[model samples]
Structures are given as C-alpha cells and as structure tokens.
Target: MRTAWLAERRSRSPAAHKTMDKIVTLLAKELRIQPRQAQVTLELLDGGNTVPFIARYRKERTGSLDEEQIRQVEARAQYLRNLEKRRAEILQSVAGQGKLTPGLEQQLQQATKMQELEDLYLPYRPKKQTKARLARQKGLEPLAGCIVLQQDTKETPAALGAAFVDPGKDVPDAAAAWQGALWIVAEDIADEASLRALARKTLWDGARLTAELMTDERAGKDFLLYKEY
Candidate 1:
C-alpha cells in the first residue's frame, strides 16, 4: 500500500532517479539480493514504513526479506545517502575554491566510503596556521616545489635556497629558507591521500600490538605470559 502511495505521490528528477538506481544496485550487491528485491525494499523504507511493518505486512513487496535483512538494507541505504550528500558538498566546496580538477572530481565520485572522501579532500580542507602555511606566506613555496620535483640540478641545497633568502621575508639565510621549504614539503607529504592510505594499509597488515610489563613482579604475576610481549 505504501509502495503504491509512493509511486502515486513521488516525482523524482532524472538525477535523483540515477542516484536511486545506483543505491539500488549497491544495495543489491552488498545485501546479496536481487535488484528487484532491493528496489522494492528501498521504496517501502522511503515511504516511511518500519522494519516490522515491512517484514510483516509488505512481505510480498519486499520479496520476503526478513526483518534483519530489511534492517541491514535500511542501515546501508542511510549510509549511502549520507555518503552521496557529503560527496556533493565536498565537490561544491572544492569547486567554489577553484581547486576541483577533472581527476579530483572523478576521484570524489568514485569514493565509496567516508574515509576515502575525507582523505581525498585532506589537501583542500581549511587548515590551521601551520609551518607550511607560514612558509607559503613567506614566498618559499617555489623552493618547496623544486625540492619535490627532485630534478637534477648543479646547485646544492644551500645554493638553491640561497636565491630565496631575503631579510624582508624573514628568511635570514639559505639555511632558514631551506628549513621553511622542508616544512612545506613535509606538510605536503602528510596531506597526500594516496601515500597516507598506502602507509595505513602497510601498518595495519604488518603491525603488531603487544602488552608490556610496567608493574612489579608481584603485581604482574597474573599475566606473566604477556610480560615480554
């Protein structure tokens, strides 16, 4: 009944229809159900029907999905909707800042999780007053870029940075300019999403957690096995 009511009352735009189709396909794949089942279930849920109501009164419409199955679908649908909303907002924010490139837009569109979206946006997000921002303000960003490019150059680090040293810019000497440039490079490396993701995966896959003994022998007698862990 609610599904029929939804069909009668709702009129979605083509973009909204596309979003719904994507949601349906994702739901079907994740929940291991047929596309028709996922579609009907999402429609019924959107019509303000409860889990028990769908499991009981709308069994036929839901393709006999149990209450647990409907609940999982509801949860996944909410997450996916939130993800899409956030993706749109991030895109708009970056575009407003004139930093959205075609590749970046594609990456944002392809992000499946909240973490992925946040990681991709890390470099563009408003940052605090950090060394990198300070260095950029002092006109040391070009030096930082040159260092990052790692091109073959006859000039040594000190010689390269010597050109940027200016008392008016607060860079007292080549050493100071090099320091600020290194700070900027460090922050750039930290903000890179791909490097961060790779490092995180490497750590998680190979890292170990161990408990160390920090108390006296008498106090730690109960967990002697973990003393050397």
Candidate 2:
C-alpha cells in the first residue's frame, strides 16, 4: 500500500514554481512572518507534519510560530494549491472548447482568487437551455450584437430588430426579436467578470442581514435572541 501510494503521489502533476512562489510570498505577507519561516513551514506541511506536531516539536524549524499560526499557514497553503489546480482545469476546459484567446488565457493565469477565476470562466462554461441559448438558436444574435455596439444613433432599436425577423426562426415581429436580443444582452452583462466583481463588492459593502422568528410562540427558545437581531 505504501509503495502504491508513493507511485500515485509521484504520478500526480506538479504545480508551477511560480504558483508556489506566489503562495510563499502571500503567506509571508499575510502572516507577517519572514519568507524563510513561511518556506520552512510549507516544507514541514508537505512532509506530513501536522500543525500541532510542528508547533510542539519543530519550534527551531518554524521560528517558534504557535499552533494557531501554523494552522493558518497550513490552511492558506492548501487554499493556494487548490486554486492552482482549479486554474489548470479551467484553462484546459476553455482551450478544449477553442474559445481560449490570448487575453483570456492571460487573465486566467493572473487570477489569484477562486471567485475571480470562476467569474472569468462563467461566459465560457457550458449550460443547459437558457434564455441566451434560446435567443441564439432563433438567429437573434445579430440583433444582439447591434444592441451591444449601440453605434447606430440614426436607426431605432425596433428598426434594427425588424431586419432579423424570420418566420422559420419563429420571430413573428420586431418586438419579439428585440426582446430576445435584450435577453442575450442581459446574459452577457450577468456573465461579465468586472461587472460581477463590482456588484459583489457593492453588495458586500452595503447589504444588511436580518433575522425573524418563525412563529410567535417559542417552543424552543435557543434562537430567541436572533429574532430581535
């Protein structure tokens, strides 16, 4: 079993040195420790030393970081390792779909957080039948492009949409075509990474939380304090 496990570990893909460097730098900065300390801590972690064991027995190696600090280092290392794995998977999937442009590849490579990477990948991800897909299927993508450009101030939106109406595509009139185009635009805006990041920050900064009692009678009052909050 040990031999097989060793072989499996050896066969696993190695993460890039650049990613490890970034993680070490982040650990040093966030933990307010020396770079050598962070590097030694990661080595200990990779050697199967638990946080408690490292804190208790490996004081000289880790510069006497406490258990809590050792644990934080372990957690952050694991998070960055997982982030690198996810980044590779996303790149492979996008490349497979032939939609991976140079700019997009660069963005994926530079993304530091899982949420940022996921937001960038949203538009490229495959989905089931959605409003955007339905609109594209009905040949309304041209109208959608026109709406996105917004360059033709002389032509009304309805007039621009009227040109795409085809009986075979089930577009009965300009209004239906325009609606479908709007749906496509909405999906595009929702998938935009910058817009999503901005919206998330806005909500995080401004949103408030509230709790309410399930009923007037409190059979179990364990959560009674939460009702008033």
Which candidate ranks first by lDDT, i.e. highest? Answer: 1
lDDT of 1: 0.91
lDDT by residue (93-194, candidate 1, tens digit) is 999999999999999999999999999999999888998899999999999999889889998988999999999989999999989999999999988999
Candidate 2 segments whose C-alpha is farther than 4 A from its true place: 1-18, 209-229
Candidate maximizing TM-score: 1
Question: TM-score for every candidate vs. truth?
Answer: 0.88, 0.83
List the lowest-lDDT window of 10 residues for candidate 1. 1-10
Candidate 1 has which clashing residue pairs, if any? none
Query: lDDT tens string, model 2, 1-229?
Result: 4466456546655556566777899899989998889988887777677888899999998999999999899998899889988999999999999999999999999998999999999998988899888999998988888878877568787787788888788888999999999999999999999999999999999998998878764664887888857
Local distance difference test, each candidate: 0.91, 0.87
